[model samples]
Target: MRITRIETFLVPPRWLFVRIETDNGIVGWGEPVVEGRSETVRTAVEQLAELLLGKDPLRIEDHWQVMTKGSFYRGGPILASAVSGLDQALWDIAGKHLGVPVHQLLGGHVRDRIRMYGWVGGDEPAEIADSICAQLDVGLTAVKMNASGRMHPIGSVGEIDGVVERVAAARDVLGPHRDVAVDFHGRFTLANARRVAPLLEPLRPFFIEEPVVPENSHLIGQLTRSTSIPVATGERLYSRQEFLPVLQAGIAVAQPDLSHAGGITEVRKIASLAEIFDVQLAPHCPLGPLALAACLQVGFATPNYLIQEQSIGIHYNQGAEVLDYVLDKTPLKFVNGHIERLTGPGLGIEIDEQAVRSADKNGHAWRSPLWRHDDGSYAEW
Candidate 1:
């Protein structure tokens, strides 16, 4: 069957969803968002759709290569994310056509259910402890939290103490068996990363995410060698080439977002590359149902998979929830801190077309907030 139509929706709480239709009536959904820049990615997908119309829906690899590299200027967040959503849809169609899940198409499942982790939010010690307990009540075995709210570039001793205290609080709630990971969100500098990574070492966090930004990945080896705590990154690294250096540098985990890092086609390759270095795959998914579904497909097939991150009750969701437009929440139901493998074909979840069409009419213009340092210098958001 040939691809017939490609439609995009900018829904509430900062999300962009893409729907691909084929002549034989099978359709696939994808999340091709760059977090805040939904409209720009939408335009990029629209431009790419011109070349995709009337093409074979099953030519996934060929379509991926052409959509990503066919353009003169290619492979940034916008183009990569646009290509990512389409790639997901293409894979979904292929899986449905073959009457198997996407993981089976990748190869086959290496294990049963993959372990998942949730996010808990709060600043104060009591609040943070309460949030962790709340997640545990829902059967999550592990939880992640921001190391600190807003950080100074060269932070004071008080800031450093606050980071340690928050982690200690989380560890206290998690006890010895449960896990907690801290997301630095690329706010820490190399020196600060060195200081904090070691301090959190005693607490034994599952991992420290984005100790430094992807741009400063050259410093990763130094940071990794310095801290006993496992260093996890790559949420911002979009290509296999980008992941190579850090992998060689001894990063403990690779957290590529399926939606931003060239979708299933490229992330599988990145996972293979990371596997050679003995690194684990903990996909960075903090978006919608389709993105989480895509991450699950990869996790099920990949042998080096560690844990999965979903956006179920993440603070980012405002008016809409993660399962808001999903017709069947059974596929994503979390139990005992793990989501069972999806048995349905394609991305393995059904999208509510009516809800999507309705949300699209009142589409959102969502953007991440900009933060500034006390000196008025720009800070990473």
Candidate 2:
């Protein structure tokens, strides 16, 4: 079927959804957003649509190559995220046309159920033990928390002790069975990242995320060698070429976001590349329903898929929750901390068009906070 039209909606709580309409009455949904830059990504998707209209929606790979390389400049948050949403829609259409799930087309599923993790702490963490307990009460066996908030390049031992205390509290609440992962959120410099990386080992975190930013790969290599805990990053990385250096640098887990990393077409390629290096997949998805659905499609098909991130009750989505705009919220239910395989065609979940249209006008221009130190120095948030 030929793609007839592309539509976008800036939905509530900072999400942008794209819907691609085809001639055969089959439509596909995608979430193409960069957390705070929803409008910019929407414009990028609109420009990319110039190349996709009237093209056969089923030629996913050809379209992907063209959408990516057709432009002289490509592969950043805006361009890749735009391509990512459109690619998800194309794959969704392809799966529906064949009357099979996306994973079935991608060599079928390797596992019956995929494990999922939830977020506990917000940008600035507080009541972490209570948050951990809340997630555990909801049947999540694993939860992730930000390691610290607005840390200085060189901080005091008291600052270091606070991070240690947060993880330690989460560990105590989760006990030995449940896993806890700490995210440094790329706020720490190489020196602090190296010094604090191994300290979390005693707490037995599942993995430490973005110990240092992607720019500091050499430091990551050093930190990985110093600690036994698995080092996971790549949420900010936009392409496979960007992922190669970090993979070669020796990360134990690759956390590509389906909404940002060129969607199913490129993330599948990224997953394959990571497999070659014995790396695991823990897709970074903290967006709305469409993004989570896209990640599940890839997670189900990928062999090395470790755990999927979900924003079911994340802090940022205060008024608009993940299930609000979804027509079939059942696919997101967790059973003993794992999501059972999706059996429906395409992304295996339906979108509530009525709700989407209604919420479109209520969309917020959501932006993350910029923090400053006590002395008015800029701090990472």
lDDT of 2 by residue, 1-381 (tens): 789999999998889999999999999999999988999999999999999999999999999999999967777899899999999999899999999989998999999999989999833335887888788888999999998888989868987878888888888888999999899998888788777877778899999999887777666888778889999999999899989988988899999999999999999999999999999999999899889989999989999999999988888988799999878778889999999999999999999999999988777789989899899988877
lDDT of 1 by residue, 226-302 (tens): 98889999999899998999999999999999999999999999999999999999999999999999999999999
Per-residue lDDT of 226 in model 2: 80
What ranges in model 2 sit over 4 Å off? 122-126
Candidates in order, TM-scores: namely: 0.99, 0.98
Alpha-carbon RMSD, each predicted model: 0.9, 1.3
Q: Candidate 2 — worst ten consecutive residues by lDDT sum?
A: 122-131
Evaluate model 1: give its lDDT. 0.91
Evaluated with lDDT, which candidate comes out highest?
1
Model 2 error, position 7 (Å): 0.3
Off by over 4 Å in 1: none
| Candidate 2 C-alpha error for residue 187, in Å | 0.9
Error of 1 at 242 (Å): 0.7
